[model samples]
Target: MRRIFLVYALVLVLLSPAFSFAAGWRDGTYEGWSDAGPRSIQYAKVFIQDGEIAGVILREYTDRLVEKDWTCYDYPPFGEAARTLGTKFVEAQLAEIDAYTGATGSSTGWMQAVERALKKAGDAKKEKQYFDGTFLGRSEVADRGYYEVVWVTVENDKITGLQVQRVLADLSVLDPDTYEGFPLEMARQAYAQELIGRDNADVDAISGATGLMNMLNIAVRDALDRASTK
Candidate 1:
């Protein structure tokens, strides 16, 4: 009787959702990026082999379009958190893990980046395209020393609303309402109007505000990624 019970438990364990997910991964390397922020964006590269997480590579890109050196002691917390997160990911074989003390923000960013990478590595087909929620996306600092942030709301697979914010190199927020004639403001309105009710960020660029329009597209796409179910 005990032997039979052991066999039954083994069957149940094999059929568990977690076990199924563990067995359904595609063996390969996948990459994902965090939502861009004022200072930097985090990146994760996940290596999967035989349906298991083999390793993870973490990186950060600064506003100046350069990779951050984790070796720098000026921010010891970030460097330590970055290293520890990579190990925890492999050990747990999961993206969700406890945040490192003093580096909660970095930990959250790294986890999201890892989650995105693992999503790409999943072999199972997703039932839904996106999860219904409001997501924030920020653009990489542009050559002109400005960036844009967008709050996107998704419901029933369609975009319901968008709120746009532009930030200068000095991190000052621009008021679109008062800056009516500004090219960036004009571009923001044009793009936001075009994106409403759309499921994706494929929209036409504003002529004089091409650069800003590109930033808008990237920011919108980044938000959509966070909303993605797959």
Candidate 2:
């Protein structure tokens, strides 16, 4: 009986999902708890990239922040009712933006925990930033002296947009309406979609568009280099 119990217990432990947590969570949720504020306990989750907090989600809050517990004659703005809510933080794209007006203490507590988590993450990755703006890059045309031009836009340290144009000696752009060769439109679409929301240095060569890919890379590299130097 004792041997059977031991074997069963071992089987149950081996099958549990907690064992999988060790290997599968590179991009995963991390929970942070604040020293409870007057209204409720606060919890936060931050998403990291390579090692920096790229995004944040406020996961839990107490009852006072959620409910307006009092009702009066023609009155709806007292107690927790008039407080600045946690929703403001979630709607904000960047955590550094601002603190809720009436909820200064809560916001400070929430940011304190998040800042601690960020410090922990910083140890995992080197910090990086990009110059935000639009840049034009050109690759010399073939021996015929025509060149390809590409525009790459960087904002908030990410590649947000790109455009490509092939120019002739007269500097007139080829009409996209009449051009059907080489899938330029498709290549352009692919480049823009794939490069957006990623670091400029992290772009990879797109398949089936090798030549244009190289040209685009040259233009983008020059553009990004110019941004960094400024």
CA shift at 9, candidate 2, in angstroms?
84
Please provide, for model 2 over 1-230, each residue's C-alpha lDDT reduced to its tens digit, 9 standing for 90 to 100: 99999999988887774343222223444545444333444445667544334457553343222322333313332223223333443344234446556555556656654543443333244244544555555664666555666666777778787777777677676765666666778887887777788766345667887776776777677556534421
Sliding window of 10 residues with minimal summed lDDT for model 1: 16-25
* TM-scores of the models, in the order given: 0.67, 0.41
Clashes of each: 0, 2
Candidate 2 local accuracy as lDDT? 0.54
Top candidate, metric lDDT: 1
Clashing pairs in 1: none
TM-score of 1: 0.67
Identify the leading candidate in terms of TM-score. Answer: 1
Candidate 2 residue 122 C-alpha distance from true site, Å? 25
lDDT of 1 at 181: 51
